[model samples]
Target: MTDSMSDTLNNEIIVPTMAQMAAEGKQPDILFWVGCAGSFDERAQKITRDICKILQHVGISFAVLGTEESCTGDPAKRAGNEFLFQMQAMANIQVLDGYNIKKIVTGCPHCFNTIANEYPGLGGNYEVVHHSQLIQQLINEGNLKAEGGESFKGRRITFHDPCYLGRGNNVYEAPRAALEVLDADLVEMKRCKSNGLCCGAGGAQMFKEPEPGKKDINMERMNDVLEANAQVVASGCPFCMTMLSDGVKHTEKEQEIQVLDIAEITVRANGL
Candidate 1:
C-alpha cells in the first residue's frame, strides 16, 4: 500500500484519513486512532507526528479518522455521563463500520482502554492495540531498528506505566520491550507495572485542578522518577506525558530530567 492520499499538515505530514482512503478505493492496513490529545494537544501532536513517521518508516499503511473522528467518550464515561459516552462511542463506531475498520492502533491508553473494553458493548468490536504494542511488533518483525541510538546509549531511562495501558488493561511488557532495544540503561520507579502509580491525569483530572491532596499525584510520581535517577522518563499516554512534563516543571527538575513519550523515543532511536 505504498500508494496513499495525504492531506498536508503544518509539518507536511502525509496522514491520509480513512475517508480519503475510501474515496481512493484503498483500505489501510490499520486505522491509526489519533485521540484528542494526539490530534490537538501541541505536545501530543509531536508524538502523533513521530507515530506517523514510524508507520511510514516501516511501510505499514495506515490512516486516521481526521475530522470524522470523535472522542471514544472516555472522559464522559469517567465523568459519570453514560448517555454522552454512548452517544460519542456510537458515532465513532458508525464511522469505523462505514470504513470496515478491523484493526486499530492508538497513542492514548484512554482511547485504547475505552474502545477495546467499553465500545464493544456498544457494538464496536475490533482488534485494538496500544501504540507501544504495535511498536514492539514492528521491532520483533525486524522492520524497525534503533540504529541511531547514540543519544540513548548508556543513558538512564525509566518507563512510566499509564493506568489504562497497564493496570487498566494488563499491558506491562510491550513498551518495556520496545525500550530495551534502545541500548539504554533501564531503571524502574518505586511503583511500576501492575502496582503503577497514576500521574493524576486519569479520570478527567487533567482538565481541572486536583481536589486537595497531600501532594499532587504527578509530584509523588515524580518522586519515584527522581528515586530512579533516570535521566529520561518514558511515557506512553499523552495525559501521562502532559502530567509528568508538568511535574518536571513543578519540581524544577526540568534541567535534570526529560519527559518523552515512547513513540518519540522510537523515532529518535530509529533516526527518523
Candidate 2:
C-alpha cells in the first residue's frame, strides 16, 4: 500500500480496465467514474489521482471506463439544455449497460448527482456513490486509516459543501467524517451544510460570464471561508474547488489559504 507518488504516476497504480476485467469474466467491485474535470482539468486530475491512490491503498477492486466515459450532462441540464442533457445521459447509459456496471464512484459531485438521482428515470439505475461517501465507508469499515503526524495534523481546516452534494443530495456527514481522520481542528463556515452558498460555478455559470451583481458568488463564498479563518478549505466537488480557488485568488488570500479536496488530505494522512 505504501507507494511513492512518482511510482504511482508511473506504473504501480492498481487500476484495471473494464474491458480487461470483462474479458477475464471478472467484474470489478466498483467502476471509478472519472468525470470531465477529473479527466481533462489539471487541478481536478490531481484529486482524481489521489482518489485512485486511496482506493488502491484500501484494496478496493475498481476499474475506470477511461475514454469511454463522457459528461454526465449536469452542466448541460443546469444550463437549461434538456435536449443535450438527455442525449449525453443516454449515450453514457449505453456504455454503462454495455459493461453491465453495477456500482460507481466519482470524485465530482455533479457527476455523482446526475448519475445517481437523474439517471434512474432514464433507465440507467445503479449504485452510484460520491468519493467522500465511499471513503467514509472505508474508514468506518476499518479499511482506510489515517496515521498520526501527517500533513494537516492539528491544522485549521474547513469543509465547503458543494451544492450538488450537500443540499442537492443531502450528503453532509461523509466528507466531514473522512476529514475527521486527519485529527485536524475541523472548522465550519458560517454558511455551511444545508445553508451553504453556491461557489458560483453551479448552473453552468462557470462556462459563461456572470450577470450584473455587486460581487461574484465565489467572492462572496470566499468571504465565508476567510471569516472562518481556516488554513485549508476542503472541497468535494471539482467545480467548487475551481470557484473557491479563484475566489481565494480574487481576495488575495492564496498565500494564506489553500483549497484542497477531501481525498488529498486522506492521501497525505496515509503517507501514500
Candidate 3:
C-alpha cells in the first residue's frame, strides 16, 4: 500500500485498467470489478483502494475495468426494471468479454450476486467472488495474515451480513472469515448469518427515501448492534455501510461506535 491509498491513484501503485492491460497484450489473473459505489462513492472508494492494496500485497495479477466499467444492473433489476438491466448487463458483458476476462473479484455483493448468478444466463459466464470471499481465500492460502493488525479487545466487533450477500447468495461465512483473521473480539448480532436483517438498503431501497411515519429499517437494525454491545460493526457491502453509518450517526454513536467495510477493516488490521 502507498500514501495514495486514501487519495487518488499514484505511480507508486500499479492500477492498470483492463483496457490498458489488453492493449499491452496482457491478461491479469482476475478482473477487479469495482461497482458503482466502490467507484464513485467517496467512502466506498477507500474500501476499493484497500481491496486493491490487499490484492497487490498478495502479488495477485489484477486489473480493474476503470473507465470501461458499467453498473452490473443490480439496482435496475432489483427495482423491477428488467429491460434496463438487460441493456446494462449486455454492455458490461461485451466489455468484459472483449478483455477476455475470466475471473472477477468485486467489493460489492450486489455485483458479485448479479455477475455470478445472473450474467451466466446472458452468455456472460465467469467466476466471480466478493472481496470478503477473496479475503478468506488469501488468509487460507497463507498469503495474508494481518501481520500487524489491530485487536478490538476492549470494543468488541460484530459483522453485519449484507442482504444480497447473505440471503440472496447464501454467503454466510466468508465475511466472518475475513474479519476473524484479525486478533479482535468478534461477536454476532442476534439476527445474523442466514437470519440476518437488512440494513434498509436492499432491493434498491437505497435510492429512494423510506416511506414516511414508519420506523426506519436501519434504525431497527441498529438496535441489534446496540444489543450486541459491539463498538465496531463490520460489513461487506457499500450500500449496507451507508445505511449502518447513518444509523450510528442518527443514534449519536459517532465517538463510541463505528461502521466499517470488511476491506477497510482488513487494511487497518494488516497495517496496509
Clashing pairs in 2: none
Superposed model 3: Cα runs more than 4 Å off: 1-12
The local lDDT score (0 to 100) that residue 41 gets in candidate 1 is 98
The Cα local distance difference test for each model comes to 0.90, 0.90, 0.88
* lDDT, candidate 3, at 204: 88
Model 2 agreement with the true structure over 1-272: per-residue lDDT tens digits: 34434555463666777888888999888999999999999999999988988887776778999888889998999999999999999999999999999999999999999999999999999999999999999999998888742766788999999999999999999999999988799999999999999999999997999999898899889889989999999999999999999988888987999999999888888876
- Tens digits of per-residue lDDT, candidate 1, 1-272, equal 24321321132458899988999999999999999999899999999999988887777889999999988999989988999999999999999999999999999999999999998988999999999999999999998889854478899999999999999999999999989998899999989999999999888898888898798999889889999999999999999999999999998998999999999999888667
Residue runs of model 2 more than 4 Å from their true location after superposition: 1-11
Candidate 3 worst ten-residue window by lDDT: 3-12
* Model 1, residue 139: C-alpha shift (Å): 0.7
Please estimate how well model 1 matches the true structure, expressed as its whole-model Cα lDDT. Answer: 0.90
Tell me the TM-score of each prediction against the true structure.
0.95, 0.94, 0.94
lDDT of model 2, residue 224 = 93
- TM-score (C-alpha) between model 2 and the true structure: 0.94
| RMSD, every candidate, angstroms | 2.6, 2.3, 2.9
> 1-272, model 3: which lDDT tens digit per residue?
34444432331356889888889999999999999999999999988988988887777889998988999999999999999999999999999988888999999999999999999999998999999999999999898787675654445899998988999898989888887767678999999998999999988889998888669999999999999999899999999999999999999999989999888888777777
In angstroms, give how far residue 220 of model 2 lies from its true place: 0.5
What's model 3's overall lDDT?
A: 0.88
